[model samples]
Target: SNRFSYSMNLKGASMTIDTACSSSLVCTHVSKLHLRYKDNEIMPASVVNGLNLMLFPGPFVGCCAAGMLSHEGRCFTFNSTADGYARGELCGALLFKAKQFNPADGGLCCLAGSQTNQDGRSASLTAPNGPAQEKCIAAVLKEVGLTPTEVDCIECHGTGTSLGDP
Candidate 1:
């Protein structure tokens, strides 16, 4: 973000977020807040960017040693056959703007409402709680004045691991 700001001469907020796999998704939620409530008059559009780079073999070697990597080199998320998660490199970005100022062309999705939560109590630190996630999704739908039936599709992020199995 800092590099992009320097090169593009953009003077917006430049920060990094690290919430493991949910880093990019959290950025979308933060973007909505920034756009909906711009404290400054000069607030411009927000660009949420996520990057995953494998610069060295340390992480790969570690996950491999811990048996947290899929032998097939592919993710089998949510499947009983899932052995472990797959790792890859990617760089992506999304630009967000208020609807009124947003151009009609090349628009992706609207930012209505977004929410975030964590599993306070769990079997393990990394173990996922299905009910907690369901509640969070339901709350977001309610905030946006929509119901589960009304929503056609939803995007999800999965680590593709069988509970980060050992």
Candidate 2:
């Protein structure tokens, strides 16, 4: 209601997604699709935002019980001593416009494409699915007309869990 009231002059669609770790990425993907289909006539810009507020005691106790909280209180993302993740709060937003809007202005970076999927029928709801993850990567690469070797960097959900870091 707050965001809609503030942006009453702006005419476009707005939505919120709660996909756990991949929420922001999914939002960007949806925005990209909107720009590709709608163009500037219907929608001029897309704003993707993510806010993570860690509530004390409640989430902390849950994570602890689930053995997801790091004993040393450190996130060793790709380290030998990787055990569990250290919780942290984060808030960020990004604005996106179609490349045709301003051809000369390349902006900060270009997003070729994005794809997301769930680990269906996994061992557990929270367990990571290696094959499903690989399929998602392959799908994204195929969508963007690029090979795995051509891509440079990828931001992944590295929660520091030993079993989850595949």
lDDT of each: 0.82, 0.81
Candidate 1 structure lDDT: 0.82
Which numbered prediction scores highest in TM-score against the true structure?
1
| TM-scores for all predictions | 0.89, 0.87
lDDT of 2 at 18: 82
Output the TM-score of candidate 2.
0.87
Overall local distance difference test of candidate 2: 0.81
Q: Once superposed on the true structure, which residue ranges of model 2 sit more than 4 Å away at CA?
A: 1-10, 101-106
Question: In model 1, which runs have C-alpha deviations exceeding 4 angstroms?
Answer: 101-105, 164-166
Model 1 pairs whose backbones collide: none
* 17-117 per-residue lDDT for model 2 (tens digits): 88877889998988888988886777877778888887657988988998987888988876767789887899898879865545468567777888888
lDDT of 1 by residue, 49-140 (tens): 99999999999999999888889888888677788888899999888875454446677667777889998988888888888889999889
